[model samples]
Target: MGMQPMEWTENALIKRSTDFGKLCALHERDPEAASAKLETMMQTVRTMLEHVGVADVNNVEQASIITEILTKKFRAMHDREPETTEETNLIRSFAQIHARVQQAHAALQRQNGDKDTSNKSPNAPHDNAVPPAA
Candidate 1:
């Protein structure tokens, strides 16, 4: 069944990634044309990332997560034998980008998580106040 409108989700992204098989078939039929199309597609995705200000100061973590999700989807789609160096690099680049995003996301989550828990920590300034006389 077709997905309902505005129903985009991580699962939906993962499911859509399987459509890469069409690109693979095209590559088999017309390697030169497929290469050009793939390059254009990659450039378009990079442009979209730039438009969203990914890996930038504003909304850093969220943007990084979005980049990571896209990288993951691309990685899943291309996790197969590569016929050329360019194809191999494409896979490698996505994996590398995904790793970097995952690391950055984890660091940000940890940093934010610590701030959230600090106030409630037993050793926090307010929590360490001396008891009042009864």
Candidate 2:
């Protein structure tokens, strides 16, 4: 028999609330604090997956991943009297990832002339975001 696949990512993120949707909601409610934490966790996952030669975040998935939690973090950065450089950079990286993913999808569509490439997109830079201590 083949080895069983390990699926620890979702479990690694387990919180008081085990529901993914509810956990996301809780994070969104405090993006200023939670976004950085979430981003760090996610980037680590991405790195580990890439190391194992299985990192594939397509355009649709990228779009879905940038949920209210991320946008609220972006907004929080902008709401400051003077947005910190670090905050601006983090939000801007998200925007750039979104744009590049969209562009890759469009290019792939044109190249294949209606043939689906599974809507795959270019990988975004795997830089980490560090939130300043409160």
Q: Pick the candidate with the highest lDDT.
A: 1
| lDDT (10s digit) by residue, model 1, range 6-104 | 223556445434434456568768988877876765564444334433334334444444445545555566675776787777677656544544444
The whole-model C-alpha lDDT of candidate 2 against the native structure comes to 0.45
User: Local error of candidate 1 at 123, Å?
Assistant: 28
> How many pairs of residues collide in each model?
0, 0
Which residue pairs overlap in candidate 2's backbone?
Answer: none
Report RMSD (Å) for each prediction in the order shown: 12.0, 11.7
lDDT of 2 by residue, 1-134 (tens): 35444334433334311333343555558865666665664464344333323133342343334432454544654465425665566556656654544444444444455465565334522132223369
TM-score of 2: 0.39
TM-score of each: 0.47, 0.39
Model 1: residues with Cα > 4 Å off, grouped in runs: 1-16, 51-83, 110-113, 116-134
Who wins the TM-score comparison?
A: 1
Q: Give the whole-model CA lDDT for all candidates, comma-separated.
A: 0.52, 0.45
Give the runs in model 2 whose Cα sits over 4 Å from its true position. 1-69, 76-82, 114-134
